[model samples]
Target: MKNTIIIIISILLLVFIFSGCGPEKKKVAVLIYDMEDPFIKGVSEYLKAFDQKSYDITYYDSQKSQIVQNKIAEKLYKEGVDLLVINPVERLSSYIFVKKSLQEEIPIIFFNREPLKEDLEYFEDVYYVGTDARESGMMQAKLISEGLGNDTENLGGFDKNGDHIIQCVILKGEQGHQDAEERTKSVIEGLKGEGFKVEVLHTKVANWNETKAYRAMHEIMSEFGEDIELLISNNDAMAIGASKYLMDNGYFGMEVDGVVTDIPFRIVGIDGLEEAKLLTKKGYMYGTIINDGKSMAEAIMQLSEYILENDEEKLQYELVDNKYILISYKYHSNE
Candidate 1:
């Protein structure tokens, strides 16, 4: 009995030592795409609102360049960061970083965008926490369809005419952005399933640049005329670019380029920006879908803490759904 009691005491001492002597201060590296972008600005702004003496957070800007980003990530790995949070620029190019991090045994929390999951699977404990783009796209699609109903003339039960078509010009992000791919696919599928004849006259890749998006909008205007009913930019920045293009060309007939009406068409996008929200209140934009960036930042912080403190098996894929969609028409010129 004495021997068993002594064994228990030894186990208790080891546990106490392990708990008390935990790794001193964790260093985190955030590899992001274009820190200058308002979206990343929101994330970084919130991070600064906390006590940073306990945590070391450094953000590396890829400047939308995968080559530079890969280099930054490798240097961070070489310096031995405890955790790495990456907002990958390219879908497949991110394997360069993910593959290297695997050999290092560092945990990663991917937010907003994702690298290839198959490539990410090599890591010991990696968490995929962010929005569900496909579902969000579907939600945007459902709203657009309802807006079309407002456009469609009620032919009445006797007339039987469900043949209302919506002319749309899509502004896609860089070639392989998951947001551009999944969102465009979901929105298109949603419209197709509803028997809506959406003629996609112009689908241009903007690379998520405001100027590039503006230039693309100019070209779209030449081809489809300024009367294009619905403008679906993959994000708010691109949507604003299209709106600016319209305003510059003096096409104020129906500054309706939101999730509202497509005739004087409404404009629509995700990642609801503050300007977009205020515009909704001021009758500038028809509506926007809010991604809740502050919520994402808070989640990133909490999840990072949980991973460090708890030794539970992490998830294979976590769809941390910020499935919140806000459709407003306060910006409608007619309203």
Candidate 2:
């Protein structure tokens, strides 16, 4: 009887050990700057759709406030998350989060918005996955030049006044955002470098908001009117808003077989959103640069897995300087 009892006890202990050895999900905390931003929304959706079997993911929205993001970062650190993925509210404040990650010993991946190079180099565990903002800006200029027939001296019919210079109105993003600043500066410089003369009629800060862009467009049109030959927006949302304003005011007239037959001026933007693609197809907007959010999410997940496993050999994406993963931008146009 003693031998039989010993056998039963040993078998129960073996079963318990095996059951507890099943693969455990890693906890990941994803903090988004703002869910309302269309580009950020797309990235978050892609992250959410990832397979949940390997990761227990929780998300927090910062509502476009840096203070709120800092609080959430603190809470998640205390809660002991294995990984923290942040799309920061402000790029300048990235050091705060980096310091927090170092103190808490949590690995961090920043996407969409990039952190300062110094902050990213502050820790070995810090990683960034994003596109080069300057590349997006250059592509925007290429699209505009192509639409104007690629001739600096004789900008074709779209020139409106045959002045050999593109009269443009720019709809800028946030005041101090890195991407906004880079995109705004690079596009203009890119145009000049390509030997195209560009006269910026007006530049307004639309804050990457569609409604604000619509209002800005209204004001711009009220002043510049037909003298404006081109519209350049920092993002697709603003471009779409400007297009809407144009349509409402009889700028784009009479759709013939689902295509706008009369488009007054060429409008271009970054971020190849679906709505922007539809607008481009219908001739309301000219072109856009593809931001490629889906691939960014995949890269972030792969990096997370690599960090969690402590295996650099398994990393699929090439890390530039062991710090950044840059996704390339592609230009998309109707032609």
Candidate 3:
């Protein structure tokens, strides 16, 4: 009887040990700058829907505050998360998180809002996954030039005053955001490079908010009236907002019997959101550049997997400079 009882106890111990040895899920913490931003919200939703069997992922919103982001980072760090994917509120403040990540020996993947190059170089394990800002701006210019018939002499009837110069209004994303600055600057440069004469009527800083862009459009239209020939926006949300204002005031087209009519002025933006694509197809908006959020989410997850497994082969996206993964942007228009 004693021998039988000893054998039973040994078998139970063996079973317990085997069960405990099963693969454990890696804890991943994703920190987003603002949940309200449409682009960021789309990216977050993609991250949330990733395969959950191997990773235990959680999301934190910074509420557009660097201070709030810092606090959330600290809390996540204390909780012993294995990895961090952050879209920083303030690009410069990335250094703070980098230092902490280095000290804690945790890998980080910064996406969307890129950090300073110097900060990214501080750690070997740190990585950035995002689309090129300048590329998006250049694409925006291409769409605009094409929409206007690529004619310097006539501007495809878009030159309302027949001055051969496009009178434009710009809706800027944010004050100091790198993407915003780069996109705004590159678009203007690109147009000039294409041998098109452009005159900016007014530029309003909308901070990437649709409501703010709506209000800014109102103010701009009030000041400039019909002299505004083209509207350029840094993102689709703002473009959509501006389009709404234009439609309400009879500037944009109204659909009648499933056909949009009475369209005036050309409008273009970056970030190829679904609504923007539909609008472009229906001739409500000119064009947009695809930011490709789904691809970004996949890249971030692959990087996270590579970090957890310590296998570079796990990365599917081409990592440039051993630190960055740049996703390409494509121009979308009604072709």
Candidate 4:
């Protein structure tokens, strides 16, 4: 009877140990400007795939207010989250949240966009995972420069060296957003390198709003009339705004056919949205590169796991592009 009791006790002890060996639970927070944005959609989708893992994702959206985003970050930090993934609204203003997270000793990963590198370099704990913004912009510029030969004969535009010297109306994003600033800078530099400098007739701030884009494009239409040869928007929404102006001014019909109809004369922008892709495919606009946001999130997830198991002192500051993904129908239709 004593031997039977010992066996039962041993079974209970084994059950206790095995039950205690379940996976460690992790709680993470994801902060973004808005969920409607494609970048956020991609990140959320990526996070959902890992539901079987021992993790929780709390979402916070700033609804286009820097102060609100800052508040959300602070709240998440105070909640003692194991990790924070952010798509910041502004570069400098959001650093205070970074400071708070660092003070609390939680790991951070800036998603889709990065903080100011100058500030980030000082904070050794923050990790950023996204496309190389400058390189992405440069790729767009190279496509435009190469299309110069195609631009003039079709659009009655002037040529400079091997590229076209088209008058550009630029609708840039917020001034303090690092991605916007870097993308604009890189595209301009790339264009200059091709021996054809785009004369920026106006560089207005759209703040990543469709309404702002529409308003700015309207102003550009009234200011330059039809003299604006091209619109190089920083985002697809702004590019669609520029296209609205073209449509409003009756620039898409028979009159555009003779002197400047053959060359594509609409707004060219990024993010590879469905509308952007459709327009580019139909010869209404030039499409852009599609950064694989899902792959980026997965890589970040792996990196975090590696760090949790390995030496934290050996943390590497890294940049990754899983592939050179350009989604232009004219160019990379295979993608």
lDDT of each: 0.67, 0.90, 0.89, 0.65
| RMSD from true fold, candidate 2 | 2.3
Ranking by TM-score: 3, 2, 1, 4
Of the candidates numbered 2 and 3, which has the greater TM-score value? 3
Over 4 Å off, model 1: 1-23, 50-52, 150-163, 253-263, 311-335
TM-score of each: 0.77, 0.93, 0.94, 0.77
> Model 1: per-residue lDDT, tens digit, 1-335?
99999999999999998988755788888878788677677876775664345667888888878788888887888889988888876667757666777788788877677666676566656766567777667767766655555333331111122345666778897666777888899988887776666778788998766678888876788888644667776777877777767667766544344432322466676677776565555444556666667767766776677666663232222433321112121212223
lDDT of 4 by residue, 153-230 (tens): 333343323344567777787786776888888888887776665678788898765567877766777887556666
Candidate 3 per-residue C-alpha lDDT over 11-125 given as tens digits, one digit per residue, 9 for 90 to 100: 9999999978877788999999999888889988887777566888888989999999999999988889899999999999999999999999888999998999999999988
Q: Between prediction 1 and prediction 2, which has the larger TM-score?
A: 2
Error of 2 at 282 (Å): 0.5
Clashing pairs in 3: none
The TM-score measured for candidate 4 stands at 0.77
TM-score winner between candidates 2 and 4? 2
Candidate 1 RMSD computed on C-alpha atoms after optimal superposition onto the true structure: 9.2
Model 3 sits at a Cα RMSD from the real structure of 1.9
